[model samples]
Each structure stands twice: as C-alpha cells, then as structure tokens.
Target: MEEFNLQFSTAEQCLKVIADEKWQEGFECRKCGRTNYCQGKTPYSRRCTTCKTDESATAHTIFHRCRIPITDAFEIAYLVCGSPKMSSYELSRRLETRQMTCWKFKKRIMECIEHGAGLHLFDIPQKSQV
Candidate 1:
C-alpha cells in the first residue's frame, strides 16, 4: 500500500481526519436516520440534529475505547499499515509510547489483517447504534 501523507500533528487534527474519512460518503443519524448533524464540544464527537444523541468518531473503529491520544493512535495505525515488517518495539520508540501499548496495538492490527475479520485499522465502519 502507498504511504498516506496524513498530518496527524495534533489530537484535534487526527479526530478531524477520522471523522471526515468515516463520513466521507455521508453519515445518517443512527437514532433517527437524519443526514444532518452537529459537531460536539470535542473534535471526535458529533451530536445528531434530530435526536440530539451524541456519537464518538471512534465508536466502532479500532481506536474505540483507546486511552492514548488520537494522534498517537493514528500514528501507530499508520506505521503498522505502511510497514508490516516494523517491530512493536520500534513502533513504540517512534511514537514515544509504552512498549506494551505498542505491542498490543500491533498485535490487534496484525490479527485483523491475518484473519480478515471485523474492521481493519483504517476501515472505520459506521455504527448502527450510538
């Protein structure tokens, strides 16, 4: 795969990238099926215009429930996707994250690719429910 030149310099930038990519084809409210929505206080959240329900950009994505900064997670995912041979230790060094965290992220990404199961790191599927 070609290397992606995404600028994930900040948490907000990463969140915006994820949200735009996830909703590129357009998004509908899970609760009311409304196409319109409003941005939440956080860059990674959105509120439905119809039902006023809040949703996270990473809700159904591999980044879901992640404790690290979105930019760090995005960097990890990008590194893994771009260089499958990269070691977790190397990734951890590059991202300045804990080795265990890097290992877990790498393992999860590898499992997704090897099994071709669920959603891959870059493939953020829209959730059916918030």
Candidate 2:
C-alpha cells in the first residue's frame, strides 16, 4: 500500500474528497438517474434537481452508518489501514472516540479485507441478489 496523507484537515475537505470519489464526473441522482443536483444543507449531502431526493457523500460506503464526524472516521480508517496491529484502545485515545466504536470500525474493515468481501474499503460492489 502507498503511504498517502489521508488526514483531512477540515470537514469540508473530507466531504469534497468523498464527493469526488463518489461522483468522479459529476453529481448524479441515484433516484432519478440524472446528472443534476443542488448543494444540500449539510456539507456531506446533495439534493437531486429532478426527484428532489437527498444523497449523502457517505451513502453506500463504509462510512455510511458512522455517527462520528466523517473526517474523524476517515482518519481512523486511514490509521487502521496503515497500522493493522494497533488496538482499539490506542485508536480511541488517539481519535478521542469510544473504544467500542473503534473496535466495530476496525472489525468491519478487517473482515472486508480478510474475506475478500465485496464491501472492501475502496471497491464498491455491484448490485446482485444475495
């Protein structure tokens, strides 16, 4: 793995990164399948121009269900990815998050990596019947 600085200094920067990754070309509405959307009230979301549906930058990604700030979650994920042996306690102390939250995120990340699961960190899986 390449040593890249994944630490985002601000929530806006983090949201931008997520948005860029999610919509490489441009914003596309998931509901109406249109390429037009308006800036949403939240920094991490957008509203479709056609269907008026809201979309989150973290939607359908590993960070989807996270309660912490997206930037903090990204930081924790980066640390975990870089140092697989680091414990949840250390992570909690470093990130100022709950140990259980750290553990759950780490567990999910490790499981995805170890099992070659479709939900691996970066590779978004295609839709399929389970």
Candidate 3:
C-alpha cells in the first residue's frame, strides 16, 4: 500500500489556499458582473458590493457542496491528485470515513481529472457563476 501524504491538515489552512486561488485574479461578482467587493460575513468570503451576493472560497471549485469536512475533503483531493489509482476503500481507512462517501467523492474527483479540468485543487476549473 502506498503511503498517504496529505497536504492540508486543517480547514482553515485549506480555506486560505482556496481563497488565494479563488481571488488571485481579482473579485468579480457572480451577479451583475461587478468587480467591487467587501469583506464577507465569513472568513475567505467575498460580498459583491453591487449585488450584495456573497461567495465563499469553495463556492464553485471542486470543493463546492462537499459532504465531508474541509480537512477530510482536502486530504482526499490531495491524495487523489497525487495518486489517482488509490481505491476508495483505502481512502476510507485513511480518512476514517464511510467507504461509500469516499467512493462518491473520489468518483467526482476522477471525473474532473478525466475531463482534464485539473489534477489538483488549484488547477480544477471552477464553474462560472450562472
């Protein structure tokens, strides 16, 4: 069995990384196409000044609507991107989560990779706000 080398251990750390990637290109409000933003109600979130719509660091990324905690999701994403062959059973043991959950999430990650959207969290193509 291969060793699991997870990159992020805490949700806060993962959120910071996501936030950096999310806003590195500057903020564009999903609604009204405005670039102005303000501090959001939550950390790493951006509130569009024009539309008053708030988006989180994980809003449109692969982490969007993630069922697992951010830390677990990050670990899964890191490991999967690192070695795409690892079975969900193996991931379940490593994460101490349900195997089915791991399988479902792993499938999602694999789909992104299969489509060439990205191999890592930062590389995953975020869905444009519609």
Candidate 4:
C-alpha cells in the first residue's frame, strides 16, 4: 500500500491523474466531435461546450462504473499490475474490504491486461492510461 499511497494519496489525486491521461492529447466531444470543453459539474469531469455532454475521468476507462471508492480501485490496479501473483483474498485483507469486491475488480483488471497483451499500468498511453 506504500506505493499506492505514494502515487495517489487521495481519490481526488487519482482522478486528476486519470483526467490528465484521458485528455493528454486534447479533448474531443464524444457527442459533437468538437474539441471545446469546460469544467464539468462534477469534479474531474469534462463537459463538451458544443454538445453539452459531460464525461467523467472514469468514463470510457477501466474504472468506469467501479463500485468501490476510486482510491481503493486505484490501489487494486497498482497492486495487480505491480505484483501479478497477488490474490484477491490478499487484496481484500489489505484493503479491509470484501473479498468478492476485490475479486471482481481484480478480474476486470486481468481482463483488460489480457485484452491488451502488452498492457500494464500507464502503458500504451493512448486513451486509457490505467
């Protein structure tokens, strides 16, 4: 958990990283195909000026619709990527959360990592950076 804390001490910090990675190239409205955007209603969200579409840092990424706190989810990703041998049981214990929850998130991370054969944390650096 030291690494997780070092990289992201809070959920807001994690969201900032995601937002920076998501819009690294620039913002393009998913709905209007426009590049103009503004601060969204929610923290770390981007709202398209042209179409009034609001997108979250978690949207269209691995963290989308995650049930746990973003901080926990980020830690899971960090641990799973850094130590592939870790089990969900260990993860749950570390997080002091439900085993099933850790298992589910771990499964999702594995699926994404497998989907992009060479993927790891911060790899490929295109749209999704987790």
Q: Each model's TM-score, in the order given?
A: 0.75, 0.75, 0.85, 0.87
**Candidate 1 accuracy as TM-score:** 0.75
Which digits, one per residue and each the tens of the lDDT, describe model 2 over residues 16-108? 787777777777786889988888777868899888889888776666766787667777777887788999999899888889888887776
Residue-level error in angstroms, candidate 2, position 118: 10
Error of 3 at 80 (Å): 0.9
Residue lDDT tens for model 4, 1-130: 5665987988889999988988899988878899999999989999998889999988877788778999999888888988978999999999999998998888778777877733433332233222
Q: Which ten residues in a row have the lowest lDDT in candidate 3?
A: 121-130
Which pairs of residues collide in candidate 2? none
**lDDT (10s digit) by residue, model 3, range 38-74:** 9898888999998899998888788887878988887
Q: Check candidate 4 and list the clashing pairs.
A: none
TM-score top scorer: 4
What tens digits encode model 1's per-residue C-alpha lDDT throughout 27-127?
77778989888886666688898888888887666777777777777777777877889998998898788888888777766766676643345453323
Model 3 lDDT on a 0 to 1 scale: 0.79
Which structure among the candidates has the greatest lDDT? 4
lDDT of 2 at 67: 74
Give the better candidate number (1 or 2) by lDDT. Answer: 2
List the global CA lDDT of all models: 0.72, 0.73, 0.79, 0.81
